[model samples]
Target: MTRDGRRGEAADDPVDDATLALLLEVAGTPKPGNVDRRRDLDDLRFEAFLGGAVGARPGLERAARAADPGAPSVGDAFVRAVEGMAARAGTNTQFGCLLLLVPLVRAAADPDRELSPDALDAVCRATSVDDAVAFYRAFEAVDVAVDDPPPGADDLDVRRGSDAEPALRERRATLRDVLALSVDPTDPDRVADRNAAEWTEGFPRTFRAAEWILTDEGPLADRAARAFLGLLAAEPDTLVASTLGAEAAREASERAAALLGVDSEGPGGVGDVDAIPTDAVHGADLDTAESLAERFISEGINPGTTADLTCAALFVALRRGAEVAP
Candidate 1:
């Protein structure tokens, strides 16, 4: 997309816009755990992520254009985009982000590029069984790290990948059906995520984050970083719970809350004395944040769900005409 207030100029094509969002998510400072522009995991480098974002751009655009009226379903677009990303990055860099973006892109593909919670809901609610099948195929394409299915869904374990395709067909489950398993009321302990919540319900958090990004006074990167911290403080990241235990996730949330000087599960607390922007306060906050990031990174605790939510927020801001810097 063109810089904000330049609506008269032709916006970046859908591919370019999606690519920029991916880059911005990884490039955000103090976005602990996940690979950013300055941090790299042993197997995943920042350069590889940039390549994966570039590689997935065309597929994301094609998915957007294909679903303008309706052709490729979100599931099909998701599988294709992840495949392209994996081929370039040689690892799973953006599978979770792609899950959120395929639907967002479809909703934004209208003549006006208008995206609302209702529009996103309609797009997801319209998913077909074929979309479910394609989603399973996408899971097979990459070894995505996910929480295990509940006892009831043991047969439909994602680790089985295409092996579960036969059962998915036998059950005639739609993409919505598959996602419902994650957030099912029967299995209260199952880890529900913002992505699955978006797929099953409307994307409440994603839309709210976007609104915060729009209203917050700062450059896009600062807004994104603060939003990331805000969300992390407010919610226990499901990815952390999935990889570690619930207690670890809770601790992570508490740490994030302390960083921003807010009560866990409370508001952003931007004006709190603990959150003041004094040089000493800022330095101590970064020191604390860096310490937490170092501990998580060393322990392999990646709050990926938080990262994915940030990407969805970035996508919304860009689609709604936020100015991005080079």
Candidate 2:
């Protein structure tokens, strides 16, 4: 992979798997409000996502080459990936996914360590203040919908992008520290930052959903679709909450839970239900899912965060030996 838009030689590589995961995630049909093979959003088309995936290969390769002395850090790789992705897509396509995948790809580069929560956590914990600055720079490369910063944290607003770099440097914030700001919110109404939570908390949802994708017996695309539904049902999408409201995000999850015939609520609260049963996911009512997809798109509700998590899960599954076959 080169900046000149030429692909490297094909071989067994985690970068290839990561790129495939992006394609499979977008290709999965009836992803409900996402641009999948069967449908496209008004502003974003399916082709852009394909171009984004192809364009992101250089950054993925950089992350996978962590052993190289000159390899970019996780945050630098992420910034490169987002810049490439936006350049090809003409907008943001997988910003959140690359945030998750960059560290995971770096963790996968360690021959002594398997791609696991602990491994990823170590990679995230090792990030420096420079990485935090790079992360903010990545945000400057594309438009990402994010909530306003908390009242006292105006200087740390992510939407400020690179403008906040001085504050981050002054505070000596690492990339993990920057993500931690979004993980535990003081305001009850603030939507949880699921991607940041994954970065700070070792990617629990991503790994769990990867297990769902691996255990389910089907085509890889169908497995990804099922995993996508399970993920959407399990949590209020952060993007939905930011774009719409918390109530709208919860309603979307509730509808997905209903389609899966599961309770959306549990002892913990909304989106704390048990793992969606494998049987239920495999036997899910596609007709109802399709109808829900139509309804969500019509209402301008897109579960973009869930889709990002699903793409990360697909990458994990692919790394763990989930094969794609006809």
Candidate 3:
């Protein structure tokens, strides 16, 4: 039970004290609920990307897929085909989300994305809320209600303007810019504008951050894997065996650390959130989208771990036209 006597299991995992500290840092933040202000763009990307097969697209679905290709590995061929469609579709969020899911679209991707121990942390960092949502729309199913409330209720507080419409109008604003790649990639001014757009409307910054984490010594996988494992609650041994190659004991220690707030080190905790440098963000972006997504997923994106709601939202927005994932 929470301090208020309500019940909450507080997300957990089995890892060393230090590792658990990092895991909790990513998972224990105060997330936006059904009626909250959070947004899980990372999880959204993963969900949308992994949700379905790209081949679901009728006529284009079976151009090269042989019903019985006696190849040693069909996964590569399938991924190549999906990646082709994604590139042709271009670098837009919708397309990017499709690209990340290329492996999944062809078949049941080894839920692990083939991450070796050397790349485990890198890939996890790679999968933060920001980048994950962009290319994983089909796999999206993270739950968050950023949708504007019914008109005239007049109770919302996020907006400070007299009229709620204008205060948070941009939240619901339609995706306006035409999808066009820049001709001058090296132009500083153009790059600034592009960067500016990405903070509020574009997802490049978030994706880049995720990409960095996935490739560097980041904590994306631990955050994602733990949340996924616990949410599924499918027996840690089985889950770890299938995914982490054997690390169930690590989850318990991590869970304890997350709840205790001992050495937490990410944006979800108040310390990490506050630790975010103002100059670093430069008045351009909002809070970390991945922080919100990871928190929400652990909290229960939809009372289940098999799917993610954020990914679903990305899919819905793309289908409706938002240029790409959240």
Best by TM-score: 2
**What TM-score does each of the candidates earn?**
0.87, 0.94, 0.23
Query: Which ranges of candidate 3 are over 4 A from the true structure?
Result: 1-173, 176-201, 217-268, 271-326
Per residue, candidate 2 scores C-alpha lDDT tens digits across 145-244 of: 9988766778989888889989998999999998888877888877788999999989998998898888888789888988888888887889999999
In the range 1-326, model 1's lDDT, one tens digit per residue, is: 34333364446445556777788888876677877766898888888878889778766976778434556677778888988999998888988888888888887775554578887887888887788888888877677777777777787887887788888888988888888777643544434565787777677767767766776655676677666776677666778878886667767777777786665433322312223232222223544676777777988878888888888888888777776753
Candidate 2 TM-score over all chains jointly: 0.94
Residue ranges of candidate 2 with Cα displaced over 4 Å: 1-12, 266-270
Scored by CA lDDT, what does every candidate get?
0.73, 0.85, 0.26
For candidate 3, write residues 229-278 as lDDT tens digits: 22222111211222322233234223322433333342112122223222
- Name every residue pair that clashes in candidate 2: none
lDDT pick, better of 2 and 3: 2
lDDT of 2: 0.85
